[model samples]
Target: MGALDYLSNFCTVTTTRTKHKAMQTVEIKVRMDCDGCERRVRNAVTSLKGVKSVEVNRKQSRVVVSGYVDPNKVLKRVRSTGKVRAKFWPYVEQHLVYYPYAPGAYDRRAPSGYVRNVVQAFPDHSSNAPPQENFLSFFSDDNVHACSIM
Candidate 1:
C-alpha cells in the first residue's frame, strides 16, 4: 500500500510539471464595441483555470490571455460571450495574411494579393514608383508648437 501511494504521488508531480511546461499565451481578436462587450469577454476568460491575466483592447478588437491555458479553450470561452467571429490575432494582421513568409514586409515589390500600405521600408528602384507616405499622417497636425506661438 505504501509503494502504491508513493507511485501515485510521483505520477501526480510529473503530470503537474508537464502541464506547467505546456503553458502558453494566446491572442484572440474579438469585436468588442463597448464596455459591456469588453467586460463580458474579460469575465469569460478570467474564469478559466490556470489563466494568469486577461487584457482586452476594444479599439483594436484584441484580447490577450497569458498562463498555463489551452489556446483553443481560451478562444472558445471568448466566443461564448456572444462573439461569434473570434479568431486568432495573427489572421487580422494584413502582413501575415499576405506576406507571411517575408520578413517584416519590407520589400517594395509586393507579391500577388498584397495589401498596399504606407511606410514601405524598401521602395522599388523603378523611377515610376510612388513615394511612401503614411496615410494616417496626412490628417494629423504635428505643428503644435507653430500653432501655439501664433
Candidate 2:
C-alpha cells in the first residue's frame, strides 16, 4: 500500500471542533447599589457568546447566569463592567449552615437569609445527633456486643 493508503487505513480523517461546556448556573455576588449597576452587570454577562440568561438581584447583590458558560469568564466579564467587588457567591442559606452565628459564617454585611459557607466556620455535623440516639445505639439489635448496663 502507498503512504496515503497506509495512513487512511490506520486513522480516519474527520474535522474536530472544540468541546462545548456543560449547561450550568453560576451565581455571583455583585454589589449593585443602583439600577445602573445592575444593568451594567447584566449587560456585560449577556454579551458573552454562550450565556442563555442573566438574572440580577440587586437587593441580595446576587447575579445568576445560566447556560453553557464558563464561570471564570462570567466573573471576569462582571469585573470588567467596573464592578470590581464582584465575586462568586460565597454564602449559603442560613439553614444550610450548621451554626448560623458562626464566627465566619455570620456576615454582618451579607444580606438577610444567608451566611458565609466556610468549612471551618461550622462545627462537625456528625456530633449533632441527639444524646438519646447515642444511648439507644448501644442497645440496638444490630450491635453484636450488647451494652454491659442492659
Candidate 3:
C-alpha cells in the first residue's frame, strides 16, 4: 500500500475508535443583590456533582456553570442557596446563545433613561464621553447631594 492509503486507513481507524462526550456549559439567570449573596450561590453550585466551576456576577445577576451536569439539577442547587433565584434561559439553536445575559437581558431601564437624559441635555457634546464621567457629573451638583447631616 502507498503512504496515502496507509494514512487514510489510520485516520479511519482512529475516527471509528474515538468517542466524544457532550459536555455543556449552562448559564443561569440569578437574582443576586450583594457580595455575600454571590458567595453563597457560588459555594452552593460548586459543591454539586459534575460542576467544574461556578462564576457569579452580582451586578449582572447571573451565574455560569460548566461541566457534565443536568440543567435541572444545577438550577435546583443554585436555588437552594436561598440567597438568589436561578432560572435557565432558553437558547436558540441557530444563534447558539453561550452566555447568560442574552441581548438586552442585562440592560436596565434606569441606566438607559439616564443615558437618554444625558444625550438630550448635551446634544452638542460628543456622544463618546465615558459613562462613568457622565454618572459622576450627575452626582457632583449641589442639588443632588445625597446626605444632609444634622
Candidate 4:
C-alpha cells in the first residue's frame, strides 16, 4: 500500500510538470518601422528560455513565438526591448471570422487576410430561435375537461 501511494504521488507530480511546460504559441503585434525594429524584437524574444522559434513579419508588425513559456512573460519580454509597447495580436484570419467586416473588427493595417477579432466569441442564448409553440397547446378540448362551449 505504501508503494502504491508513492507511485500515485510521483505520477501527480509528473502530470503537473507536464502541464506547466506544455508548448504554447503567442502572437504579438508591435509596430516595426524599419529593419532595426524587426531585428530588435526578434532578438529580444529569441533570448528567452524555452523559446523554440521566433518569426517576425515587419510589414504586418507581427511576432509569433512558439515555445514552452508563459504567454504573459513573453509579452513582457517583448515590451522591454525599447520598442513600441507590444500588444497581443488581436486580429484573426479574415476567413475565420464570422463577420470579417464587422465595425470594430476591421483594421486597415492588419495583414491582407486578417481582421480584428472583435466579434462575439461565444453564442448568445438570447439570440437563439424561440422554442416552437403549438397553436393547439392552449386548448384542452381533446382531454376529458372539454369546454362547454365546444
Candidate 5:
C-alpha cells in the first residue's frame, strides 16, 4: 500500500473544544492577627490560576477569592502557606460551635436542643424618673453628691 493508503487505514482525526467552567467566589476564614498573615494568605490565593480578585478583611479574618478555581484547591493553597487552621466561611460561623446544622439551631420550628440566647428588656421598677435622661451625665459632669467620692 502507498503512504496515503497506509495513513487512512491507521489514523483518524477529530477536534474537541473544552468548555471552561464559570468562575465562582470562595470565602475562607483565616485568623490573621496582623498584616503579614493577611498578606501571606492573599498571596497564596492569588497565585492560583484564574483568580479574578482577592479581598482580605483582617478584622473578621476572612478572605474572599473570585475565580474559576476549585474551592478545595484554593483552600489547600491557602493552608500550604503555613496556615493549617484555615476553614471555609460558613464552617466558621459563631453558632456552629453549638449547632453543626442550620435546622438544628437556626430553624425556629426545630427541637429545643438549640441554645439561642435571647435578651428581654425589663424596665427597672425602682426608677420612675423616666430613666436617667443622660446616663453619661453621671460620669461626664461629676455631681458633688456623688457617693463614689466618699
Candidate 6:
C-alpha cells in the first residue's frame, strides 16, 4: 500500500454543527375589554409549556408572547379562556368585523387620521399604532358604518 493510502485511513473526519434558532415572538390580536379579561388571557398563555413571557396591553388589545412554544398552541390556550378570543394578528384580515370600530369596545376602531393624531397627541400611542394601522384604516368614514361599534 502507498504511504498516502495509509495516511488517509487514519485521518479523522469532522462534522459541521448547526445551531438551533431562537424562538420568535408571536403577536396575537385578542378581544379583551376589562382588567379581568386581560388577566384571564395573560394567565392562560403564561401557564402553557415553553412560554417564556407574556405581555398583554389592554389598551392596544394585543398580546405579545415570546418563547419556544408554537404560536398556534399559544393561541389555543388564550382562546380556551372563554372570557375572550385570541387570534394571530396577521391572519385577521377582516379587522373591521373582528375588532369593530367604535370608541369603547375592546375591538373597536378609531376614526380617520386618528392614528396620526394620536401620535401627535400622545407619542406613546405612535409606538402602539403600527400594529393597529390596518385595523384602524378599515374604519375610515368612507367605509360602511354598519361595522362601527359606536
Would you list the C-alpha lDDT of every candidate in the order shown?
A: 0.71, 0.86, 0.62, 0.82, 0.71, 0.66
Compute the lDDT for candidate 5: 0.71
Mind giving the per-residue lDDT tens digits that candidate 3 earns over 1-150? 699997898777443563543588887778777778788888888888778877776655668898878888888888888733467742232222233243333334222212112222322345675544444544535666563332
TM-score, structure 2 vs. true: 0.76
Better of 2 and 3 by lDDT: 2
> Over the stretch 1-150, how does candidate 4's per-residue lDDT look in tens digits?
999998898777443344567899999999999988888889989999999999998888889999998889899988898754789998888777766776787788888998888746323457775765676765676675764446
Overall local distance difference test of candidate 3 = 0.62
Q: Which has the better lDDT: candidate 1, or candidate 4?
A: 4
Better of 1 and 6 by TM-score: 1
In candidate 4, which residue pairs clash? none
The C-alpha RMSD of each candidate to the native structure, in angstroms, is 13.5, 5.7, 14.6, 10.5, 16.4, 15.1
Which runs of model 6 end up more than 4 angstroms from their true locations? Answer: 1-22, 91-150
Question: Which regions of candidate 5 deviate over 4 angstroms?
Answer: 1-5, 8-16, 91-150
**Candidate 5, residues 1-150: lDDT per residue as tens digits?**
699998996787776987896889998877889888888889989889899999998876678999898899999998998989988774333343433343333534222333222221223347653654555555534565564323
Order the candidates by lDDT, highest first — what do you get? 2, 4, 1, 5, 6, 3
TM-score of each: 0.51, 0.76, 0.46, 0.67, 0.54, 0.46
Model 4 lDDT at residue 150: 62
Leading candidate by lDDT: 2
**What lDDT does candidate 5 reach at residue 139?**
54
24-142 per-residue lDDT for model 1 (tens digits): 88988788788999999999999999998888878767789999888999988888888989987643335444344445543343334343343343344576867676655555376
